[model samples]
Each structure stands twice: as structure tokens, then as C-alpha cells.
Target: MNNEQRLLLLEKAKQFFRDEIVESHITRACAKAGKLSNYNVNPFLFKYLANFLKGNDDPRSIAEALVLPRVLGSSINTSFGMRIQKLISELFEGFGSTTPGIDIEFIDAIDGSKKYCQLKSGPNTINHDDVETIFGHFQGTINLGRTNNLNIGINDMIVGVIYGEEIELSSHYKRINERYPVIIGKSFWHRLTGKDDFYFELIDAVGDVALEVDGTKVLEETIDALSIEIEAKFS
Candidate 1:
């Protein structure tokens, strides 16, 4: 696609993400947590939203770093990670399932086979123990499938880590690779979007959104609402 077309597409994607993914999920979480109706106006939310609305680079290492995971929790890392994971799944248009052992489960339209996906936010976010735990679940799925004479097996699983360097698995963990290999960084993005630069393009789109005049106004409004909510809730 041409530059203009790409930008337009990105804008649409941004809007979808903001409305369908981000806003919807945040609204539910805030309601459940009994926060302000517009609690999403906080700094962490604003930073990422403003960056996307204005198309600027995210100031924080992780976009949602400042948002709290729990009402009283200090960090929003987990929340941010979950959002990213959901965004990726949305980008791929995959079916999200809360299956016991997998984060997402979908049918490969080409092969007519089911695929289970496990997502991690960063490279080092997963360790030996994490792999083992997931593998145990995977094994359970396979065993159950076999006992029931189902078609599911090792070939149907994929593990993806979103950011950071590739994982260096030791010999013990390497066996896991035989059944379900972990994909990271470029490989992961390429597998999902068929474009190695998809990640960079997304970052650029976010920056571009942050640069828009209308985007700035939205940020200001969010901040105003947030400020009012904070005063009413805490004071």
C-alpha cells in the first residue's frame, strides 16, 4: 500500500484499538474495580493514548508502566502486557479462547487444523519454570485429546514472546522446542503479520497519532476528567 493508504489504515487500526480493545476492556476493569467512570484518563493511559492519538514515540520504556495493575498496586506492567497481548491477537484476527493451557485458540483456515497460542509480553518474562508449567498444561491437552481420539497434538501449539531479545534455552528446556518452539521479536511479528517491519510501523503510527491537533485536545480532556475524578475519589 502507498504511504497515505498505510497511514489511513493505521489510523483506522488505532481507532479500533482505542475503542474496541482498549476502551472496552478498560471500561469493564474500571467498573469492576469501582473506579471513576473516566478513570482511564490517568497519566499512564494518557501517555499511550496521546502518543497514539498524536503519533509520537512512547516516553516510557513500556507504554503502560505508570498505570496501576491493582487499585493500590504501584505498577501497571501486567495490565500493559495484557493489553499488548490482546492487541496482537486482534491484529491477527485470531479467536481468543481461555482454554486451560492456551491464551488463544483458532483454526488455521488453510490447513483446517486448530492452533493454540501462548503469549508473553517480553523475552525474559518467561523462564524455565514458566515453560515447564505451560508444557505440563500442553501435555495434559495432548493426553486428553489422544485418549478421546481427537486430532489435537504438539503441532498445533505456538508460543510467542513480544519484546526483548530471543530466549536462550538450556539443554533441559531445549526439548520443549521439539514440541512447541518459542518465537520472539521479528519472527513472531512476521509470523503474525507477514511483515518484519510491522512492529516498527505500529510504533510509527502511534507517534503519528500523537502529533495530531485533535489528538492533543482529546488528551487535554482526558486529563481534565481524570483530575476531577482523582480529587473526588481521594480527597
Candidate 2:
């Protein structure tokens, strides 16, 4: 697609997230769980949410804030991580086919290689235990694929750390790294979009959409509405 078309699609995706995901899912879920109710409401939470909504220069923080509200309250206990995974998957689907699985499956357009992707938002998000567990599952999948004579294997898998610097890995992590290559930051985005600056372009596109949509106004209105509702419930 041309640059204009790509940007238009990105705008549509952001709007869909704001309307369908944030409004329909996150806001409603928070309301249902009484997140803004007097019993659960507090100045600190209010201030934090306000600050998050105000805006951040960091693209990752912007993306997270846009979706964080949806997973609050009862939704927090279920599907929180999955929700993020799905969002990332859908975002990449703009470039390639992102199929559902324990890890995301992306079919590279240039080489037709199917990459089974394990994504983490930050380096610290996955700890040593989490790495071991993920490696175990990934290894099992590779073995199962080999046993079934499938075309998938360790060569087709990648662990991507999205919004952080490269992590310091222990000996165990090093072994896992040897088996399944890990890519971080710019390399990860380059692999996904086959472009050197896809990450920056994406951030720019999202920022443009944010400005057009007046996200800060929407957030302020939302907070005000919720605060009034909570006050009414208490009064």
C-alpha cells in the first residue's frame, strides 16, 4: 500500500480501538466493576488515570494508556494479557496475516516464512521463571511440529521485546536464545514491517490520529462523567 493509504488505515484502526474497544469494552467494564464508584475511587487512582490520559511523548506509553482502561476492574482478572496480545496481533495484521495461537503467527510477505512470535511489551515484563515457562512451551510446540512433520520449527520462531532495551540474559536464557533467536526494539519492528523505520512511522501515525481525535478532551470528559456518576451513587 502507498504511504497515504497506510496512514488512513492506521487512523481507522485507532478509531476502531477508541470506539469499539475503549468505549464499548474498557469503559463499560470499569463501570460494571465500580472502578469509579465511591467505594473504589480514590484521588491517587484518579490522578494517575488523568496523567496517563493527558498524553505522553512516548508511543508505547500512548498505546498502553489508550487500552489500559478497558482492562480495569473485573476484566483485569481475565483476558488482560490476551487483550494486549490481540491488539498487537491486529496491529501487525495491517502488514501481514496475524493468526491466533499460543504465540502470534506472522507470514512474511517477502520470504513466505511463518514466524511464530512471542511478544513482550518490555524487557522486565518477563522474568526468569516466565522465560523458562515460555521456553518450555515453545520447545514443546517445536517438538510437536517436528513429530507431526509440520513445517514449523525453532527457525520459524522469534521472541520480540517491543518497547524496551535489550535484556541481560542469564545462562538459561542464553541457551533458549540459541534455540530461538530473540530480537529487540528496532530489529523487531523492522522484521515485522520489512522497513527500517516502521516503528517511528507507526508512532507518528498514531500521534496524528490522537491529535485529530482530541483524545485529551475525550479523556477529560470521560473522567468527569465517571466522577459525577460515582458521586451520584454515593449521594
Candidate 3:
């Protein structure tokens, strides 16, 4: 569907669940969640309803629960940017997808640069014990030794990039020698999921991107656009 069509569909879907219903769901959800101030009301309520109405239920329910606030904040009623940012920050720090049950340290140790950059922001340390707070979340971990040793050359680094919901891209460094040896290792693992599929790439030293995940070139522009969005948001 086109962008407009998709938007319209989302709006229509959102309209199916009015504010009253959402509010009611939130009330019940808050009670069920009980004193969890940082709890995501939308997802909680969505899952609750999904438990009752089990058919073709997707993340749309959760998305719809967000629409009202999104609209209100987008309108002249309020500046939802900060609130949205706060929610996102909490979601990531408290319940980000990177590590579902186990929280990883989001340290400001490096940037896009391949050097020991000063830690501008403090690291967010998460431990394994904090997983049960969120019911459904998972993530994978890559085990690379502490030493700068690897089966591959120091310059040769294999990496996996996860995009959107479930889109994962695995590729090796094209120019390992030209870049620093940074190992994206996992100290722990968590259960996390996504909607988008993964794209695996084996990057050679010559900067060539080889599709390692199912050899197929889908909409390259779409992927480029998605990456641009991630960079813009993360940068």
C-alpha cells in the first residue's frame, strides 16, 4: 500500500478503539500491572485484549493505543516530542529490545568513529536479574573473547545489523585493516523479537557488501531509507 493508504488504514484501525476503550483498558491494565509507574500502558492493554480476542491480532493494537497520545501531542494541545522521547528513553533503558530479559550496558565508549572516544554520556548498566519485569522480550549475544584475538584477522570483523522489527543484517567488514578492531560481543543474551526480516551481508575489505542472508536484492532504496532514519534518529 501507498504511504497515504497505510496512514489511512492505521487511522481507521485506531478509530476502532476509542479513547474511552483505551482509557478503560489502561485502568484495568494499571491495576493488573500494579504500581509499575514506567509500565507501557499500550502494550499491556493490547496483550490483555489479545488474550481475550485471539485472531489476526498483531502489533496494531499496541500501535493504536499509542495513536491518541501521538495525535494529542502532535496537535497544538501539547508538545509530545519530549514526552515521546522520555517514553522512548524509558522503553529502551528500562525495556529496550537490544536485550529483553537481560539489560546491556549502553556505554558512550564509541561513536561512528573507530577509536577510543571519550564517554560523553554515562553508560546505562543493566543486569540479568531485571528480565522478569517485562514479560516478552528477547535478544541474542555474540561471544568474542576479551582479547583482541579472533578466528578471522584483526582487520576482519563480522557483524550483524538488526533493523526495524526483525530485519537482521549479518556481514563482515570489507576493509578490516583500514578500520579499528571492535568486537561486538555479548556478555549475556535476552529474548527479543522484531517484525522486519534480517539482511545478512559479508563486507569485504574492499567495501563490497555481499548478501549473506538469503541471496536476494529486495528494495535497496527501502533499506537505504530505513538506515537513513536509524542514523538520523541515533545520530
Q: How well does each candidate superpose onto the true structure, as a TM-score?
A: 0.52, 0.57, 0.15
lDDT of 3 by residue, 108-193 (tens): 22231111111001011112342222212211122232233523222222121111111111222222213423232121001111
How many pairs of residues in model 1 come into backbone collision?
13
CA lDDT of each prediction against the hidden true structure = 0.56, 0.56, 0.26
lDDT comparison, 1 vs 3, better candidate: 1
Give, for candidate 1, the lowest lDDT window spanning 10 residues: 59-68
Instruction: Summarize candidate 1's per-residue lDDT along 1-235 as a digit string, tens digits.
Output: 3467556556765765566544543454433333345235465455565455546424331122222343224223455565765665555454676667777775543355677778777654556677688888888777877888987868787776665445553443355667786666666655555456766777666566445423333333334444455456544
Q: Clashes in each model (backbone N, CA, C under 3 Å)? A: 13, 1, 27
Candidate order by TM-score, decreasing, is: 2, 1, 3
lDDT of 2 at 34: 31
Q: Candidate 2: give the clashing pairs.
A: 26-70
lDDT tens digits, residues 116-208, model 2?
777665444556677677776677767777887987867677776665445654444455578787766676776766666766766666556
TM-score of 2: 0.57
lDDT for 171 (candidate 1): 44
lDDT score for residue 91 of model 1: 50
